[model samples]
Target: MDEQTFWELVDRTGPDPANLERLADELSDHAAADIRDFADHLARALHALDTPAHYHAVATSGASFLGVRCAAVAAGNRAYRKVLGAPAALATYTGSPGDQLLPVAERAYRTSTRADWQHQTAVSTHTGSNVAAWGTSWLHPHMGTTTVEGLAPQDYMIALRHVALTLDADPAWRSWWRQSGLTACELGIVAEGRLDHLRPSADIRRCADRLRANFTCASPHGGADLSARAVSEVRSMFEVIRQAMSMPGLPPTPPVPTLPADVPEVPVTAKPLAAMPAELEPQGYLTLTQIQEFFG
Candidate 1:
């Protein structure tokens, strides 16, 4: 369907909860099962929203279940898009031709306290265009010391939008790598490290070789082309190393010196240990009383 038609349906119909439930009920047993599975997977995804590790896990799994080619989750504001290496156009929700549904999804994410609201879409086979599908789910903030209020709702919305877009583009293998906490640059560095470590394992070595090649081809400026699944795996591996390196008791780094090369050095001198008049001293040491008496 065209974006205009899809949006017109949304505007006219709004979100009919009862109608959605009925649609779910009308699905064939297998399709219904898949939908249920998708919902469950989404819940898990919400739970992992805040954690880098969990974010990678949920993003990867959600893409796989939904059959998307690539997916990403981001936190913070628009600055994160640059960090993730997304195209400048993709970073903002401009309500453009390809992104009409984004504003709706962003609103849902902002207001919904729970992580139950979700939106889906499909890619047109003929046009290679993304068409909006329906989605319902809540937003789940990452767990830890901070609460949901601590996070930027826009960031969550962007992540959701990415997942939906990937599902539309490639439902066969969900793409979750885009939502990972690690930026593309960070992923590349981690991948480089892994290649070095797994040199002994032929299978791993081969995989690493492919990853290295892909990394080179993508170029830091170009976009990542690997499946979302591969991105997730590489990101997960990177996280493991990051955590290990962050552990306590690691040797501290030495401080860098800041002294100037042109500064002059000062000289040092030592003074005599004892004080005695040379005139009072004879070939041998003179007793103090004898010397004093002679002087007197």
Candidate 2:
């Protein structure tokens, strides 16, 4: 089914309390299992890119793991783009909404913490086809060096070059099976759990089937409707899982931590990394002299 139709159905169904309750009960075990698997796979992907040399490896691995169409890192400044290569002018139409640029990154930098941002976009491509993009953005400080006084800009440039190369060469969709499969598993569990509790008069089965079909159709193109429903369902299931794992008669489970609605830009001031001369090893690290002499 098309995305518009799928979302129309979701809007029509709303969030029926009876359906949610049933879904929670039915999907508890499966949700738990899926979360565990997701965590494990995420951990492994991170481990593989733990080194500075492997930053692009990390991005590629994450994109593959998350089943997104494409993944990129965007720096706080318009001049800086992430994981792709070098600072450049922003794409004319690519500015994020003001509210979308919250202070999440600033807070993380201040605390030297890591944070993730989740976002979705719908845009008409040059070909006039609608393309949807949704994914997470992780912002954290570069752990290598806080001080680059003795370092030349070439050193930094070379480092960025390596990062770009890594991203370019690595697989774009690394963990599709684990992440997407887990999502499907969770959906199934929710559908089954609520099956019995739905009243004889209720069309819960039909609703679930519609959601499933819509979800499958939307996966390929990142349909807005399916994305919204998936986010809602996953969030609801997460809460259920928490409550089920909690002590009996305890207070309600806490909500999942959400990415900031706004990510404020944090200024990064650094001497631009200088480019190494053509004769030297292209990928090798540059020296302080090389940076000074080249740019001087």
Clashes of each: 23, 16
Q: What lDDT score goes with residue 154 in model 1? A: 28
Instruction: Report lDDT (Cα) of residue 170, candidate 2.
Output: 30
lDDT of 2 at 230: 36
> lDDT by residue for model 2 over 1-296, one digit each (tens)?
23333223223323332332332232233333332332233233223222322233223222231111111111221122232232122122123222111222232232332323222122211110111111111111111211213322232322222232232223332222122222221122111112211211111112231212101101112233432443344334334433433412322222211222221222222332345588874333223343222212
Residue 168, model 2: lDDT of 23
> Candidate 2: lDDT of 81?
26
lDDT of 1 by residue, 45-70 (tens): 22222222222323323222111111
Off by over 4 Å in 1: 21-296
Which candidate number has the best TM-score?
1
State the weakest 10-residue window (summed lDDT) of model 1: 212-221
